[model samples]
Target: MRIQTILALTDFSSPAEQALERAALLAAHHQARLQLLYIAERQEAKFCDPQARLEQRARQLSRRHQLTVQALPAAGDALAALHAAAAQADLLVMDNRLHGRWRWPTRALGLLARMLRTSPCPVLVVQGAARAPYVHVLVHAAGDEDSGGRLLHGAAAMHAGATVELFHVARPRRGLGLACGEAFARALRSRRQRVQQLAQPLQSVPHTRLRVSDAFETRRNRVGLATRGLDPARQLLVQQQGTRADLLVLAHAPRGVLRDLLQAGKAWRLLAGPEPVGCDVLLMPQRGPVTARPEAAGDAPARQSAVARRWTQAT
Candidate 1:
């Protein structure tokens, strides 16, 4: 996953702005070319006003990041416009809508999922506030192996010598084990090594830490979701990327992750805020090869694709 070029699609909302902030951090961190995109709502050909607004918005976003921006207004669907523009992208970053009419179903996550299913590159979707200090990267517990492996592989490949940490934040109750002491230590060790195996070059990439928190405060039915351990995964990734990570990479988790986010109503946070403090983020979607995972005999060659690589630019 070489993110040589990145595209950020904005709807000109606060959420979109947040996505732009994330893009800027990434552009600055990786030194990758950043393209800011705005797709105007379709209007009659005689109407130039919307196109002008779109261009103006694109320029504003581009100037903020100190890079070239591309604002496009098409006569068709907003999603179609974005999909057309992102043909050459290594990654696409967008905010998740959290409230009112700007909720998930209307936002780009579904489109993101469509893109993910067949994207030439990976897609990263951030809604609401994620966690901070992204020294670690977590893959979804039930994600495809390549999706899981790519997170570690990409981190290891990057020459930054940044430590790679991977952990699964499971929903409360069922998936989470509650034993203490040795049981906890053993579980952590096993999961950490599993992450390392995918990360490769164990010596070069150090282990951070992994934890399992109950998604809910208690096992009983609750009025509203109080995201406990696993809930923080999305929050940490979204919030921490700008400040701590040069960039952050994550695969799409199962519906459980999205559901919790929706319940929390943090969708707006996905687009409005400044990027992970100082650092930028790379929100990646799965874009594995035709045979993403292969047998050791079959996979070694592709596995040897290249060490995780980073695209760096001067801030």
Candidate 2:
């Protein structure tokens, strides 16, 4: 998989700056275009000149690598500015926290999560400097043959810098104990691998790691996942040992009944305000391969439905 372009938003803080570095490295590795931007908040104008700051940051970023930076200037909400810029980007990169403030890291991550739902591209959350790009990528795709393959491709494309792993959580009809988590994972891996080749060629490469994980914990041979309804594997991105990922990519399967349920629940969870993830989520519609799905589009359809209801209510 090739990364055609990368978009990194910076607040001039250390964490944000580190995110820029990661973006630069990925862009350089893939020989893709890099766009570095800084949005100056109107109300908070210590470094208020958006154009000037953008230009300065762009120059600094360019010096660090052999690339041209696109500077964006916007008034009003800083988050809005970054969201607009992300409109044309393939992947959105930013830090989990801002510099100097010592604020909780999740504060910036929350905004990134909302932006992810609406972003046309996948979002990458860089939390401090980590040892790996992505050792194990967690996937939430479940379907027959065609339904889940598209999401797997998305995982590889977005995580071109790291190895790709396939993870699928199938809820038991009766509950949880009866399900075969390992066997299910193997089958999904076989199907997905047939659709797309792992980055490693000829044989597996130590330079990169790619494998599939089931909801079951490999350690105890027993399930770490909840028995049925609440296995985090079906919902949240839980931190796993020896399998940390620099980014998390998810493809929304609109047609699959199971995926649709999970996605709807996920949207409601985000809308209620704040989630427990420190990583960025790239929520793309399962329209097909290589097509970008932004969250703003989802809002339009939902908002239209609400308007239709209000009209019905007035009558």
Candidate 3:
């Protein structure tokens, strides 16, 4: 999506700081306005001036990134404030509570997953160490086709030339006592259609020397989730291990792929597993059309040139 405004929520912790840095870099990359929000607990607000602290932090980031940084400081409920602020932003960047070192009252993953389910805008969950630009992106394309496609296109815009692996798991073919041949043929046709639908967008991204390749590769595997009783999340992790991506994208909705995955708490398992994910996880909510910012008539060339130069130098 055209990210004109990015909102970042922080509690001033280490994980929050890392998320802020990522938000800043993304804001600079897209030439978008960066808004920093800090919500003070009622007790803390009574003791300290949260607005002052927020303004001070905003000024620092603005100078550091050479971009306008808006400071939004509020007291009381944090999630309530976050939801209100998110309405005006194209994307919300925040620290996944699961990554926090300290113990929290609520399960961080559950909270974040709920936010992912309800947030009006896309949310990027930053985990692990900072990687300035993601070079390898692994996308779990198990949800709606439109949502999955938008997530990929938006990612391509952010990290030009990164190798994107579109991974999906199809339900394993079940035995049909009667009409076995017809059943298999129908299943095969369905699988083929799903692959084409997911791959259609990437095929159109033009290749250029100045930018990263928009061309993406797809991997589809069949698992007998129902009959074999396999874990969808574990299976996904196994595939992700093989790809070794720098980022993982998931389009979460109540029903469909996410329901199957998250119902088993797979999202939490993926992030809080013993082995580190070793990449950033971006969770996007399924919504209407996701389009890039509409540029001025003459701005396209300049923007493209700037993006090309950045990627060229980075590479």
Which is superior by TM-score, 1 or 2?
Answer: 2
Residue 98 in candidate 3 has what lDDT? 57
Query: What TM-score do all the candidates reach, one by one?
Result: 0.52, 0.63, 0.68
TM-score of 2: 0.63
lDDT of 3 by residue, 1-315 (tens): 678999997767677788888889889878999998884232354436767877888899899989899997566667777788889898888776654343232233345655665688878888755657777777765443545567666665655556766555432222211211222233335566665665555565543111111111112212223233434455556556656777787765533334534343455667766554666787777665444223347643544454445334323
Give candidate 2 misplaced runs (Cα > 4 Å): 40-45, 75-84, 97-110, 130-136, 143-148, 158-161, 174-209, 220-223, 226-229, 233-239, 252-315
Instruction: Locate the minimum summed-lDDT window of 10 residues in model 2.
Output: 98-107
Task: Sort by TM-score, best first.
Answer: 3, 2, 1
Task: Name the top lDDT candidate.
Answer: 3
Candidate 1 lDDT, tens digit per residue, 1-315? 565787877666666667766666566556678776664332356544666766776677567657666655556676676777688777677764323354445333444435544555656555433333244443333233445566655544433445444433332322223211222233446566564465454364444333232212223211112222334344444334422444444554323435544542222233333322233334444453424222345533332221111001100
Clashes of each: 27, 2, 4
Q: Please provide, for model 2 over 43-155, each residue's C-alpha lDDT reduced to its tens digit, 9 standing for 90 to 100.
A: 35576565687677778777777776666665666677777778877777876532214223322334543564467666666765643355455555454134535556666
Q: What stretches of model 1 exceed 4 Å from their correct place?
A: 40-48, 57-64, 73-77, 98-120, 128-148, 154-164, 169-197, 201-250, 253-315
Model 3 C-alpha lDDT versus the unseen true structure:
0.61
**Model 3 spans > 4 angstroms off:** 40-47, 75-77, 99-105, 108-111, 144-148, 173-229, 255-264, 274-276, 287-315
